[model samples]
Target: MKLVAKREGLLMMGFKGFTHFILVTDSQEAMMMLKSEMDWRSNVGNFVEDVRLLIIERTVTDVVFQPRSGNGIAHTLAQFGLMEGTHFFWEDVAPPWL
Candidate 1:
C-alpha cells in the first residue's frame, strides 16, 4: 500500500490585548501532551521543547486547555482538516464558512 504523507502548518494571527491562549480539544491525551514539561530523551520531546520555547519567548503568555463539546466554528474547521488532508493557507479574508 502507498502511504500518503500529511503536512501540517501553523498560522499565527495578531490579536490585540490577548495575553493568554486557551486550546480547546476533544482529546484528553493531547491536553496532557501539551501540559507536560519538555522531555529531552525522546524524539517527540523536540516538539514539547518547541512548545516550551513559545511560552518562554512570551509568544503566548499562558496556555490552557478546554474540552470541546462538539460544537462551534472550530469544530467545522477541524472537520475540514480531517476531510481535506489539512494542507492549506489563507490570508486577509477567510472563506465564507469561516
Candidate 2:
C-alpha cells in the first residue's frame, strides 16, 4: 500500500513539473532497500522497479532517510489533512497557505 501511494505521489510530482525528489523514510531497512539493486521475482520487487522507472523518467534526483523521531512538517501536514478530512491533489499550483 505504501508503494502504491508512493507511485501515485510520483505521478503528481511529475504532473507538477518536478524534476527532483528527495525521498524520506523512517526505517533503515527501507533505506537500504531503496539503495540496493532491484529484484524482478516478486511483487515487492516489481513495485521497486516501477518506482525506479518513475524516478528516472520524472528526473527524480535522490532518496534520503530520516529517523522516525523527527518532528517534521510532513507529519504536521498529514495530521492536518486527516483531522480536516481534506484530500487534495494540486493540479496547477500548491495551496497558497502551504
Best by lDDT, which number? Answer: 2
Clashing pairs in 1: none
In model 2, which runs have C-alpha deviations exceeding 4 angstroms? 71-73, 76-87, 90-98
Error of 1 at 39 (Å): 0.8
TM-scores of the candidates are 0.54, 0.66
lDDT by residue (tens digit), candidate 1, 1-98? 00011002212322233335544445565446656764657765555555555444435543444455655655566567668875444556667878
lDDT score for residue 51 of model 2? 76
3-43 per-residue lDDT for model 2 (tens digits): 55467677878877887667676656655766788565788
Task: Give the range of the ten consecutive residues with the poorest summed lDDT in model 1.
Answer: 1-10
Q: Report the poorest 10 consecutive residues by lDDT, candidate 2.
A: 71-80
